[model samples]
Structure formats: C-alpha cells, structure tokens
Target: MDCRVVVEAAVPVYDVSTADEAVRIAISKTGEMLNPDLNYVEISMGSRDCPHCDDELEPAFIAADEGLVALELEMTVFNVERDEHAARIARKEIGKRLKNIPLEVLEIEVLEEEDEEEAEAADEPTETEPDGGSGDEDDVLPEFEELIDE
Candidate 1:
C-alpha cells in the first residue's frame, strides 16, 4: 500500500521581520536541509486557525528578531503495510533531514492501488483495426532501431 503523509514542522528562523519573511526564510531553510537527500518531499506553509474565533492566522510568529514558522511537509510512502507504517516512514525520513525541528503527523491518506491501475488502463490506447487487419503494421519502431535498419 501507498500513503500520502503530511507532517507539520515548527521551524525556527532568526534575524527576520514580518510573518511573510519568516515563512519564506523558513521554507528556504527547510528546503536546503532536505535537498540532495530527501528532495522528493514537498514543503509548504502550514495553515493555522484561531481556536476561539476560527479566523485564519499567519503561519509564522515573530518575537524579538526570532520567529517560529509553521510548515507542512508532504511525502508519499510506497509499499507500506499500513497507514501508520507510512506515517512512521515519512516522519523518520523527514526527521533525519530537519534535525531539532519539531514534527507532528498531521494527516495520512491511503492511496488506492486500484485507482492508479484503472487510470493507467484508461490511458492506454486500444489496438483496434477498422480494416480487419492484425494492427501489426501500426506498431511504432524505436528511433534507434530504424536508424540501425537504414
């Protein structure tokens, strides 16, 4: 089974002003930490809502030239036995890159293998011939093969 996992991370950024700058710096810093190793992971700004009013809030909070930015990291885990397994794998993999950053598993979505297979099947072209031929003549030859034959 495959699962899509979203993990929330609290990344700390220093010497920053404004929530936007904090979030941008945090994203760039996180990407640098994960690159050349776990480059497949997708990083985005985390969403936060006020608990009392449910009003949308900024992903970063700045205080005294320091900021704690909320970021969401998404990655897909393949061939896992269960959703929990997938989440664990994702956390472990991401944690290794972002050391000392707090991580929480926000969401785990199981990907349906059947759906992927069905979509792939739908994309394949049918090999039907209107003139009752075997359709062998319609087969495309590889460019290298054609060159070699010529």
Candidate 2:
C-alpha cells in the first residue's frame, strides 16, 4: 500500500532564550534522530497551536515561547507501507535516536495513503462462507450452531 507515517513529538529545549533559537535546536536535534538508511525523511518544528501537523496539515506557529520551550514537531516517514506496524517501527527508531533529547512522542498518524485497495477495504463489508455450504445458518451443524449463532 502507498502510505506515509507521520510522527508527532514534543521536544524540550534548554538554554535557549529566543523562539528562533528553539527552532534551530529542535531542527538540529531532530536531524540527529533521523535514520540515514531511510529513503526519505522530513522533520519540522510545529507551532504551539498545532504540533505534529506536517505540510499536508499546514501547521501554523503563531508564538515562539522562549526559555525551555517544548517545541511541537513532526517526522514523516516516506516510501513505506501504510500500516500500523510500519508506523510503530518508525516510531521506535525515532524514539531510540532521540533518547538523549527530552522528547515525548505525541502520536503516530497516517498522513497519506495512495492505495485504492485499502480504501475499498475500509468501505466494504467482509464476507465469509461456511465450510459445508453458503453462509446460511442451516449449513452449520447442530454441534456448531451456537458458535455461529451470533
């Protein structure tokens, strides 16, 4: 499936007195956290209003708080399958790399998925057939009637 993982995190900056400084530190720290092996990775500092919102979400940073600002941030994992497992793996790697930084991951969201089959699966109801015959209740044996009663 065509999909991308977006990781949201809050990083606390120390010894910084200006918003720009906080951003610089955040970016640098995030760059260190990225995996060089990944095909594509993008990191950005989020605004106080909406942290973790990437380019797709169009995040807006209105005010830059100084002095130990916990900047909101996002790391997008590209060229990966659009699934929970991939997202978790990416999250773990990010957490491992950012162990030195006072970072707290907020959430991992699916930023984009370009898979038609996955979209259809979400909208379609699943169907299954009994071993003996069609899904009709009579097809189930008396001993297994209770199992499929629901």
Strongest candidate by TM-score: 1
TM-score of every candidate: 0.81, 0.47
Tens digit of lDDT per residue, candidate 1, span 32-114? 99998998999999998999999999999999999999999999999999899999999999999899999999999998899
The ten-residue window of minimal lDDT in model 1 covers 129-138
Please give, for residues 14-79, the per-residue lDDT of candidate 2 as tens digits.
666566776677667667666574425567655444346533322323244434434444446555
Instruction: Show the lowest summed lDDT stretch of 10 residues, model 2.
Output: 54-63
Candidate 2 lDDT for residue 89: 66
Candidate models: Cα lDDT each: 0.92, 0.56
* Candidate 2 collision pairs: none
Candidate 1 structure lDDT: 0.92
Error of 1 at 20 (Å): 0.6
Q: Where in model 1 is the C-alpha error above 4 Å?
A: 119-150
